[model samples]
Target: MQRKAPARGFEQAEFQARTQKAQALMAQQGLEGLLLMTEPDVRYFSGFHTLFWQSPTRPWFLFIPASGKPVAVIPEIGAALMRQTWIEDIRSWSAPAPQDDGISLLHELLAPLARRGARLGILKGHETSLRMPLGDWERLVRALPGLQLTDATGLIQGLRMVKSAAEIEKLAHICTIGSATFDQVPKQISQGMPLEEVFRAFRREALAQGADDTPYLVGGAGPGGYADVISPPSRRPLQAGDILMLDTGATWDGYFCDFDRNFAIETADDAARRAYDVLWRATEAGLAAAQPGNSCQDLFQAMQGVIAELDDQSGDIGRLGHGLGMQLTEQPSHADFDCTRLQEGMVLTLEPSLGYGDGLIMVHEENIVIRADGAELLTRRAPPELPVI
Candidate 1:
């Protein structure tokens, strides 16, 4: 299916801004060149997409250096798409035939840098699996003997954590789609409707409203309704007394909007309402901790405090929110493992859900920016306790 061109927005300008932003990182890391093989990083630097990622048969990489123009090593079939991107230098290779070696083509792309000591940085290198086989790595090593290789994950993540103005606008537009689709969910949902059908309805509605991609959507409708944490939407039927929780996100122009709300099929039960109230309170605490100059851990701690107060002993995910921008999930995660401070340009989601015998309730909300005063709420309306239907 032909994807509708992204609406007139800030994506074009944002792409340029991101490239310039990465230039400084490359210089700072002392990297002669950086190779981007993963989806998020590839999409971040180059506005391109491909499903060829499923196989290691032909690996694609984007090579960027501090001082010069970037180059793309892609399959010949995708050469046209690569040319369509802003990056000017791209090399195409024919499929690996018995006569032609794929590694030689990759080395040919990187051969010029052999004299520069071939100090290359690979992002998400340790995490590559079948798509980037060991043979490819060995070929790169053998192709450039004595090359100094390093992990570029941190350098890449740092650049991505901060959102440019164009990025913020794109994300806000995605949020608009999510809010509009959510508003329609209550109207479309009904008792006895299968949960799977309801979920599909939301997906169709989101695409109709101009969603370029669906990044995250996991929810369910069971006897007592769905769980707190996002589980995949299932075939469970929506009983008259059951509650429905649909937490989903739509990615547009490389930006994402993650928002979820709980819907009561008929009447709001006392147990469900009470659980929702606690989750809402936790979400408020998370928002309060999102001020500029605050640590990401602080925001997570605030949410944890709420979960600790609950008498029930359900295991909490221990993180209040995560940064949302070009990728559905980005850096500065609100967890003990991360210590990055909040900045004015950062956008984050505050989703704190509690699961107990009282029935699961999710209070998912999101905010963008750490303003001079405080944080800005990106989501339209707060999640409802019950469906208005």
Candidate 2:
């Protein structure tokens, strides 16, 4: 089925500014063009958005040269949509073809760059993966001989970390919606309700509160606390004295707000209450330390110092938090090993977790944008005390 493209997602000037920034980075890196195959990269530069990407049978490609407009090489089904974007060069072919698929077209687009001895950058690194199939990538590599393929992961990450004013506004709006939905938990949720039902109710509330979509929602419930941060909701009823945590990556206008809140079912235990306080204070420390010129590791340490005695459960949940923008999780992980500098305009999350008794854990998260003087909260600050339902 052919999909009609809506008008450009943002003003033309927004995309134009992004293109100029990317071109400047490409010039600094001595690269001729960027071969963007991921959804976020393609949409970021071209204002192209489609849920059609859910299928893996066909791959879409976007090429941003060192200068000038970007070119789109996508399936014919997406031609109408690509035309709606700022891109002018739209190359399409019948995709999912048993033999060719869109490989020939992609190779043709890159052949000229190869002939000119140009270095082409592709996103390949931590948290980044090739959207195209391995067989297709191998074939393209063989077809484009002498084309210098380099890791442009850093280049793309550097550009995406800083959110434009419009992007920040969208992010802040979604976060506000999420916070409102969470506010209804006390009234909407109750003891004995199944975890799965709680998940459904929370998602419905988010939608009712103006969320366009809820892409990610994972949570857990246990007597003292949850053992894992990313587990799917279970069918077990929410029992009294259990610590129930709900983490969501709710979206509005393609922008996502990633955060979570904890609720005590009926009553709370001393261990759970103390753990919540520790996590809350840790997040406060992170917020106080988040400013321009500070590194991500520095932020991690500040939070870690606040709860050093408590077992740091951040290792179990990956980084404390990560850069958030177009995707639910982006670059610049908030971990001791990550050295990415905290720059103004970067949107991030300060998540702090601690282990309580009986192998239980509690995680608290908040979203913020790095500002010139300090960090500005995106999501309304969660209540300092754990709210008991």
TM-score of 1: 0.88
| Residue-level lDDT tens digits of model 1 in 1-389 | 23334354445566677776777777777777887777667777877755556565666677777765567777787788877777788777786543443566667766777756766777663223324556667766786875778788788877777777667777777888888788788778898788788988999988887887676787766555465556766676788767777778788866788877777777766766777767777788887888888888888788778866662645356566788876666666787666788888888888676666644445556656677677887778665444545
Q: Pick the candidate with the highest TM-score.
A: 2
Using alpha carbons, what is the TM-score of model 2? 0.96
Evaluate model 1: give its lDDT: 0.71
Which ranges of candidate 2 are over 4 A from the true structure?
A: 1-8, 312-315
Please give the distance, in angstroms, between residue 350's alpha carbon in candidate 1 and its true position after superposition.
Answer: 1.0
Q: 181 in model 1: Cα distance from truth in Å?
A: 0.6
Q: Which regions of candidate 1 fall more than 4 Å away from where they truly are? A: 1-13, 49-57, 96-102, 116-118, 124-131, 228-230, 358-363, 383-388
lDDT top scorer? 2
Model 2 clashes, total count: 0
Per-candidate local distance difference test: 0.71, 0.89
Give the clashing pairs for model 2: none
